[model samples]
Target: MATSKLHVAMYPWFAFGHFIPFLHLSNKLAQRGLKVSYLLPKGALPKLQQLNHHPHLVQFFPLVIPHVDGLPPGAETASDVPFPLHDLLISAMDKTKDQVETILGNLKPDIVFFDFGRWIPSLTRRLGSMSIYYSVVNACSMAFSMVPAKGLTLETTLDEQIQPPPGYPSTTVIIKRDEAPHIVLVNDPPRAASFCLRLTAILKESDAIALRTCNEIEGPFCDYIAQQYSKPVLLTGPVLPETSATQLEEKWDKWLNKFEAGSVAYCAFGSQITLQKEQFQEIILGFELSGSPFLVALTPPHGYSTIEEALPEGFKERVGDRGWVHGGWVPQTLILEHPSVGCFVSHCGFGSMWESLVSDCQIVLIPFLPDQVMGARLMVQELKVAIEVERGVDWIIGKESLSKSINLVMDKESELGNSVRNNHVKFKSIFSSKDWQDEKIGTFVQDLQFILESGK
Candidate 1:
């Protein structure tokens, strides 16, 4: 009998950032002849359907977990809910366990790949399939900053940080030193030297672990992670469908007529971070003050009582037709590709950063919260590609700082603007000239094939 098609199931937390990457992986796996199934709530199906072109090899299951009390009813995606990250995680864990158990019983997948939501370990173990934890962030980041592990079982009070155990690269710890003691040592990297270590200690104890980053941008670090884990590292790249400048401009032009050249600034934050009302107002005013045409994707705060009412008076009128505020989904890749889009004001999510880099647009980073600050620092300091806005404690960026950063990047005649544009071109050529699809995705497919054949 033809070897049964490798049956794989993917479970991502119901956020667009997490879901999109997982979907891209599934599409790649499907192209490589593996059968893939995605488990998420029903409402996310349309979004996935829009992105997916390969229907024959992949399928979706609508999970029917009960809604949490505080979350909005019928909220399909995390963006739809106003719940805080911690509460959302808790509810997702409970719901995921119930939904996954039911799906596993019916589907009996050969392998289940999941985002590192808290409930996956127990659910995968009970199912007796190869359970692979697919992390969307850099392995180094996770290794250093993850909470200590208590046990595989999902419980309320596991205060342990996740860290690499002994035998990994001692110097490459991703978390801060002060946070080290609280971490639960794992077989993954920054601690282990090779996949053999990870396999024997972590994978064998659990199932498998995979990283979502590719070799082009993160080759050495990815090699380190794979060696430490002793398991195949799947180097899926940025995981976006390829598009050209011509096509991108066409799409943007269709949306708004005035976008011809150097007209619009594209702005968006990744799904998770929220801005305080004061900071949000500062951004609104900053964009108003910059006098540049702009398009902003804003997700109103879920908890803060005053969020929706915080827009500056006459804000919409002043920027009429010159600015567009999309409270829902905006086609980001399309906007960035537009020739008229000169600069990006972004929250600096890695996915957004990669998208911006590939699009060859000048970027002004205004990080609102979490690891975004680190990403912004990387772009400004290490990559020398983007300009970062100065912010006070807790990332409350002021209007003046925001206006200055936007003006500096958007001013095409200015030295700072020219430098950013040059860097943007350089980064674009690096990523776009090479067939990242072939170099990165090709290797990932080969390794995944090897893993499947090896039967371990």
Candidate 2:
């Protein structure tokens, strides 16, 4: 008899940062001739479909988002809701477990890859399917996550949490106490409780763990996770798709036409982070001080409607003709690949990290939240490939610090800048090697096939 075709399913957290990488992995698997069913909310399907991935091998199955009490009408994903209501969105997502289980029951894939499907571990086994907990964060964050949060509780001192977790003596912990989410510190107890519960479930129940990093990037942490969990840990090699710059819109094309190669600063803070008014002004001021022709994409905090409302007064006229500030949507991957772009000022989201690493651009990391801080740590502390814009108590960043960070990374002459830039070239070389990436991903695929065939 011909062997059955391997079928896989993927369910990612609704946030775009989480969702996009899952989609990339699905596409990669599909290319390798595995059938994939991508499960997500209906609202996100349109944008993902536009990526034009493997139509035959990968299929999207949309789940209706149930009504959430605090969630605004028509808002389905984390990006659609304001920050305060994010937990409510997760609660609503949890309600979709029944529907998800129903769909998975019918599809009956060999293995399901999931991020934030908290009920997955229990449901998968009952349905005769195995589940893989796919971490969208870096390996350091995963290593820290496997550290029991029960012991590291709300009362735990910031100093205590900042130290390296038990076994990793030499490695510095990437996340600072202040840089952690309010939920983590018990500033919001209910949300923290919910997050902890889900994390615990995933940790206790999953059949395997998968990460989006390679041994070269975070080998120690990767090894630690395997030893801690005693489960197979698959490293998915960052899943960076080979991309070329697409035709830019008139506005961006016209603006970028003026700069010399590698002279402009490209700043984007990903889809979820919204800069407060004060923070926004400081970043703009820093860009002005750096005197680099730049492009900034800002998503203002809730209640603000426009870039004009968020920026400092007269900020536009002062930097006139030298910078472009686009609110809401900007083509980030394309901009990163642009010849005129020299450096990336980012929130250090993992997807952004992968994109920046794959490009020639030097990185200036301003990480305000959980895994973002860990990503910054991995680049700056471990890899030495990026500069972090410093934040004070409670993770609030000031304008002077922002400006200084920009100037520091953009200055090729300075010692620190030269070191970081050289590291960037080194990482970019590794990420760009098709053979290296193929070897990693190929090993992961072979291991996955072994697990399914041997039922390990």
Candidate 3:
């Protein structure tokens, strides 16, 4: 039996990146017999139904999302619009406060898990419930940017940000100079100037804090967050749900099978990281230059409507059947597990970081955001399981640098190549174990029960 019959409410940010992970944890809790009320955009219901493995125990509460000024009509999730319009979507989410409050009042969940809503604590408190600020991002990212002592502001310079947040534990895993722009929130709207400030406020006000990480990979960083925040820092242990039963589509299956085992390099930037036209051309050309069988799945880059329009000159004629460049979503988990896929070039989204960790493919990082950069650092600098693509001063990746990073990892004889391959295998073995993953989820439930029942 579950530790208690506690009802948990989840309200993650509207992004599918956030929605999927939140539901993964919800399924784990539901498996233990706890009930979950997942609050999400109304349009996401159809997509989420396929992922919710426990329909009997988990219930979806599709939110009636309100349209706000500047957001395109029906852009319910982050993937529906360009990255620049994220704040406008956030503004729309905030406008749903009244709708959410009514739902919470009716559902009367014992505990609510939320992120990106600084108002959740107050709203839940008023409803006579406890709140957990469950972060979908990793502890290292939160520690680096969102800690209270960071004093993060729009004026915060790159030099200052590269320095560790006060009492931050990691030395080698800091963001590089070029990647700092993603963190400082320089281009954000006035209301969204610095997410760290808002996140810090939410952490301070929340009854408890939780992250999607385990101490094995980011122990000191998780510890720092718990210590600095002065709250229970609960961990969900890199909760990547199993998608193994989902087979790769036939087109990709046939294409990948033609290559020798571990010869094809697959590159995907998760939902949010769209490269500029110049950068996109450089990356695909870099893949061609590598002379490896390649698959590149990315959204159309900025200022372009389609992948074909953005391809480098003569790109199609030169690398005709050897390269597969997709402009739409492919089954990433299935693609990663394909026998012929040797390397994964990714933006290191927190979810992607965990997925990469548990996969057999060699990892290469091309992070475009702060959280992503932090996740990359753990893999590259600390664990030595991956290498990052070096970017020019403008933070644009060079074709040569991208190809070199892939070739370096794919080269079996090189020292760095051998070391990264060995490390990836070592970590993969640990994370891929079903029992280890289950134990983490079990402990997570026990702790939540303790907090909810005992009111700790």
Q: Please tell me which predicted candidate would have the highest lDDT against the true structure.
A: 3
Q: Which ten residues in a row have the lowest lDDT in candidate 1?
A: 150-159
TM-score of each: 0.77, 0.90, 0.92
Q: What is candidate 1's lDDT per residue for 6-107, written digit by digit as tens?
A: 788888767787888888778767766778888887777886786665688888888775667766667667678654433554465466576678878788
lDDT of 3 by residue, 148-207 (tens): 666555455433436444423233223233334234323332333355677888899999
Clashes of 1: 19
Tell me the tens digit of each residue's lDDT in model 2 across 249-327.
7777778879998889999887777766767777888888788888999877556888877777888889898998888
Task: Give the TM-score ranking, best first.
Answer: 3, 2, 1
* lDDT-better candidate, 1 vs 3: 3
List candidate 2 segments past 4 Å from native: 1-4, 153-190, 392-394
Residue 444, model 3: lDDT of 88
lDDT accuracy of residue 13 in candidate 3:
96
Better of 1 and 2 by TM-score: 2
The alpha-carbon lDDT assigned to residue 268 of candidate 3 equals: 91
